[model samples]
Target: MNVNRRLNVSEVGDVTVVRFVDRRILDEANIQEMGQELFQLVEEQGKKQILLNFAGVEFLSSAALGKLITLDKRVKSHSGKLILSNIRPEIYEVFKITRLNTTLDIKDDEADALAAFAALQAT
Candidate 1:
């Protein structure tokens, strides 16, 4: 897949780790591009396991959250898995408030997220 300016995509074994470079995903254009890139990775690149590393991200708009939900559904439909990691507590609290925390697979770090994917593979 092509490189995305908004996202830094990498591979860890069988898992594709996507890191968001933009701190605030609030704009429509950037959000759409981010979602499309993620979809392409799954549909074209056949990435079944994904880890979204939010180490530098500090803000996410509601629209951005919607994009994430859409991406999560796409991954699940393909029988794939998506895990989120390194989300700042404030940003994570948004998920909790929206009750998306229950639906999304969130972890504390990339290593933990990778481990979770490995555990899923073992099951």
Candidate 2:
């Protein structure tokens, strides 16, 4: 497991789960750093299965959302999977409003997200 200032990265089985440490992911620099770290996990570390846990994140700026979208595309381009879990209702609503809910795979909890990954690997 690795802990960055804004992200707590750990492994669950074959999946890398990154949990946000900040309550509000609103800063552009922080958002950019998070995106780079996630991309590194996929591009450099070869961790294609990623689960982003949003339990601590209460607010996110549009910039943060943009970063997430880019990360999602990067993972997909690698023929990998990205999932989000434990999202606050307010944050989930933002994804829904932005129509990202259709494009992203979101789960209710860490267990569910991990199980989804396991299922994917089995098939």
Candidate 3:
């Protein structure tokens, strides 16, 4: 697709690795733009294994979380998988408080997340 404005997209093996361009994902307008880009990866690009690396992301709004929830559903509908990695403790606490930690597959780091994806492929 066209150059992603809010994310950097790449592929690692069979997984699509995505990194945020914005560290603070709090702007309402940007969140919507980000959501569309994320959905395009699954809907048009037909990506199944998606991993979001949040190493640079320090803030995530609830609206952003809603987009992730929707993205997770879209991935599942397509028989795909989505994993989140390298979330900072502060941002992670938000996920924990929202109970997203239980719903989303999160890993301590990118390596761990990739391994988890491989494990899923093995089984």
Candidate 4:
């Protein structure tokens, strides 16, 4: 496993599980670093399945959201899948308000996200 400053990365089967290092994802520099790291997972590291567990995050800035959008696109462009799980209600509200809920695959928990991944493979 490689070192990550903004994310805690692990693997469950073929799925790459990524947890945020910060509770609030608002800092510009950290967000930038985080974005690069995320992009590298698909662009450079060849990760095909990514699960972003937002269990520790309480807030995220628009810039952070932008990075997520970009990450999702990059992952898809690689024929990979991205799933978000364990989002707090407030943060989920933000996604809903932004209509990102429709654009991204989200689940109530890591288990559900993993199940979704398994379902995809089964198909």
**Which lDDT tens digits does candidate 4 get at residues 5-84?**
99999999999999999999999999999999999899889999999999989999999999999999999999999999
Q: What is candidate 3's lDDT per residue for 1-123, written digit by digit as tens?
A: 367999999999999999999999999999999999999999999999999999999899999999999999999999999999999999999999999999999999999999999999999
Give the Cα error of residue 120 in candidate 3, in Å.
1.0
Question: Model-by-model lDDT, in order?
Answer: 0.93, 0.90, 0.96, 0.96
Clashes of each: 0, 0, 0, 0
Model 2: runs farther than 4 Å from truth?
A: 1-3
Q: After superposition, how far is residue 46 of candidate 2 from its true place, in Å?
A: 1.0
Which is better, 2 or 4, measured by TM-score?
Answer: 4
Better of 1 and 2 by TM-score: 1
Would you give me the overall lDDT of model 3?
A: 0.96
Q: Report the error of model 4 at residue 31, Å.
A: 0.2
Model 1 has how many clashing residue pairs? 0
Candidate 2: tens digits of C-alpha lDDT, residues 1-123 = 444677788888899999987789998888888888888888888889999999878899889989999999999999999999999899999999999999999999999999999999999
- Tell me the TM-score of model 3: 0.98
Model 1 per-residue lDDT tens digits across residues 1-123: 387878899899999999997998898999999999989888888899999999999799999999899999999999999999999999999999999999999999999999999999999
Model 1 TM-score, 2 decimals: 0.97
Of 2 and 3, which scores higher on lDDT?
3
Off by over 4 Å in 3: none
After superposing candidate 4 on the true structure, give the runs of residues whose Cα lies further than 4 Å from its correct spot. none
Worst 10 residues of 1 by lDDT: 1-10
